[model samples]
Each structure stands twice: as C-alpha cells, then as structure tokens.
Target chain A: AQSVTQPDIHITVSEGASLELRCNYSYGATPYLFWYVQSPGQGLQLLLKYFSGDTLVQGIKGFEAEFKRSQSSFNLRKPSVHWSDAAEYFCAVGAQDYGQNFVFGPGTRLSVLP
Target chain B: DAMVIQNPRYQVTQFGKPVTLSCSQTLNHNVMYWYQQKSSQAPKLLFHYYDKDFNNEADTPDNFQSRRPNTSFCFLDIRSPGLGDAAMYLCATDQGGGNQPQHFGDGTRLSIL
Candidate 1:
C-alpha cells in the first residue's frame, strides 16, 4: 500500500525564522509527491510537486521541497516564514496509474509567533 | 481566478437527512474527485469521475454517491449523513486520469445536527 507520513504533528516557529517540515512515504515504485497548504475553512492549495527530474522543486509563497529517493522523504522548507504562513500542511503520494489514487498524510499544523 | 468552485461554503443538515453538494469547474478537465476531510486529519478520497465513468473508493460507504452530469459539473449526495459525516467536503479537478496535479475549490463545510 502507498502511504505518506509527516512526523511532526504540530510545530511552532517565530516569524521570520527558518522552517522545515519532514515527510516520508512508502510506495512500491517511484511515486508522485506533492505538498499542499490549507487555511482555516479553506480548501487545500498546491505548494509544489515532484513528478521527475529535479529533486528540488520550488513552489509559490516562497516555499521549496527536496525529494530524496534514498530516504523516501520529501521535506518542505522555507528560508523564512511569515505570520500568514501559519496553516495546515499535508504531504501526498500518488501512483502513476489509470485511476486517481492519491493518499494524503496526516497534516502538520504550523503556528507562527510574532 | 478560481478554476474550481464549490457552492454552499457552509451547509448544515440533520442526521439521516439527504444532502447534496455541488462543484463546478471551468478548467474543462476530464477528471473530477470528491474528498472528505475531518478536523485534524488528512483528506480521504470518496470517489472520482473520469469523464462519464465513475470510480468509487473501496472503503467508501454506500451512503455516499456522486454524479457528474457533464464535463464541467459534479455532485456529491449523502443518502444518510451521520454525525461523523460532519466535515469539509472538497472537490478537485485534473486534466487526466494519472498522476496529474489537481486544482481544489474552497470546499463546503458540512455540519450535521
């Protein structure tokens, strides 16, 4: 079964501080990985995705993620986080097949302190 | 601009009552999906429509049904919404069947009374 795991359940960071959220996955083959952000009462917004080629991918809102094959990890990072960046982040894995089978990990709640 | 849009941003219903949520997309994507997301948890795939074909997740309950009248519109109907069904219902669209990035709507928060 393909599954994703985000180790941190909740994280608190000071505004303008660096942030890193770890994600790990288990799949039979190379899977498509993605990061999504969700604010209160809003749907998810795609942050970035890793299909192939470049292991490091940049996304909107000054976010980037590195997909490490050996560690089966796709960790999200930002040089600095803003107060508005406080939200729920999710890591998802999908098999490259006919039917859409996207599996999302338990979200990590991020809280930014000014 | 919002590509995917879900109506009734907030919906409240009585237990065991039937309720329907609607989603529309301007992307004209071939695939549409419905997901259930509870508080403090990840979103779970309920079903999806690839064109006119319908695909339901194996673990999805019988109470949950979906309809895609056309390429641009889709509906999710819960025959008997339980208290546990009180959660955010998200609708997403993609270009094709496989590994494509999806565009999500603001979602409808369904509250069961």
Candidate 2:
C-alpha cells in the first residue's frame, strides 16, 4: 500500500514571500505524485503532477514541484504567494493497483497574510 | 465548457434522510470518483467507477453507496444521512490512466441536520 505524509498542518506566510510545502511518500516503486489545492466550499484544483522525467515540474498559478527519488519527496514551491493562494493543499501518491487508485495525505492549510 | 458539473452546489438534508447527489462530466472519461472531505481534512476516496464497473473502498460504510449507469453520469447516494457524513462531496474524472490529470467539479456541500 502507498501513503503520503505532509508534515505541516498549517503554514502562514506574508505576501510576496517564498513558500515551500513538504511532502513525502511511502511506496514500493516509482509512484505518480500530484499537488492539489482546495478553497473554501470548493472542490480540488490540480496544482501540478509528476509522472516521470524532468525532476522539476511546473504547474499553473506560479507553482512548481521537484520530484526527488532519493528523498522520496515531491515538495511544492512558489517564489511569491498571493492572498488568494491561501487554501488547503493536498499531496497524493498513485500506484498501479486496481486501476491507479491514489492515496492522499492529510493536507496542509496555507494562510497568506497581506 | 464545463468539463464536470455537479448539481445543487449546496445540499441540506435532515438526519436519517436519504440524499442523492448527481455528477455529470463533459470530458466523457471512463473513470469517475467520489470523495468526501470534512473540515480540515483531506478528501477521502469513497468509491469510483470504471465505465460500469463499481469499486468501493474497504472502509467505506454501508451508509454510503454510489451508482454510475452510463459513461458520463454518476450519483452518490447516502442511505441515512449522519452528522459525520456532512461534508463537501467532490466528483473527479480521469482518463482511466495514470498519465492523465484528474479534473474535479465544483462539488456539492452536503449539510446534515
């Protein structure tokens, strides 16, 4: 079974400040990783995803993540964040079992200050 | 165009009442998933369907059930609404493969009174 761990429960950062959200996964083989953001009263929106090749992957809304096999991590990063960026972020790991079922982390809540 | 559409952005149901939420996708993906997200928690996968094939999570309680009659339509049925079941129900669709991204609908905010 595959699982994801997001150490940070809540993160607060000022506007224009850089941010990094840590995510680690436990899986037997190479897994597909994804980052999703959900605002209040809304469903999740895909921030980015990493399947293979190119350790660094770019996503919408000025977001990026690096897939490090050695570290077993795919941390989401942004150089500058807007107040609208404040939301709950989730890290997910997908495996090749039962038609690519994904296991998700608890989630990290981000609060951006003005 | 709306790739995924969930009817009744907000839904309120009485305790022990049965409620059904509908999800329709324009993407026409073969795979559709239903997730339950509580306050300050990650979205938990309740079940999913690959075309007409239904798959439910082991931990999913009997109170929760799902049905997908066609390729583009799916429904999440809550037999007996409980306070714990009150949460935002998200509908997502993928191309039935790992390489494709899972697109999500706006979700239905289910409130149990």
lDDT of 2 by residue, A1-114 (tens): 888999999999999999999999999988889999989888889999999999999999999999999999999999999999999999998886556588889999999999
Give the docking tier of candidate 1: medium
**Backbone clash count for every predicted candidate, in the order shown:** 0, 0
Please provide, for model 1 over B1-113, each residue's C-alpha lDDT reduced to its tens digit, 9 standing for 90 to 100.
64999999999999999999999999989999999999898998999998998998999999999999999899999999999999999999988744788889999999999
Q: What value does the lDDT take at residue A84 in candidate 2?
A: 96
| Top lDDT prediction, candidate number | 1
Which CAPRI quality tier does the interface of model 2 achieve? medium
Tens-digit lDDT track of model 2 for B30-89: 899999988899888999998898999889999999999889899999999999999999
Model 2: share of true interface contacts reproduced = 0.63
Full-model lDDT for every candidate: 0.94, 0.92
Candidate 1 Cα outliers beyond 4 Å, as residue runs = none
| Clash-forming residue pairs, model 2 | none
lDDT of 1 at B4: 97
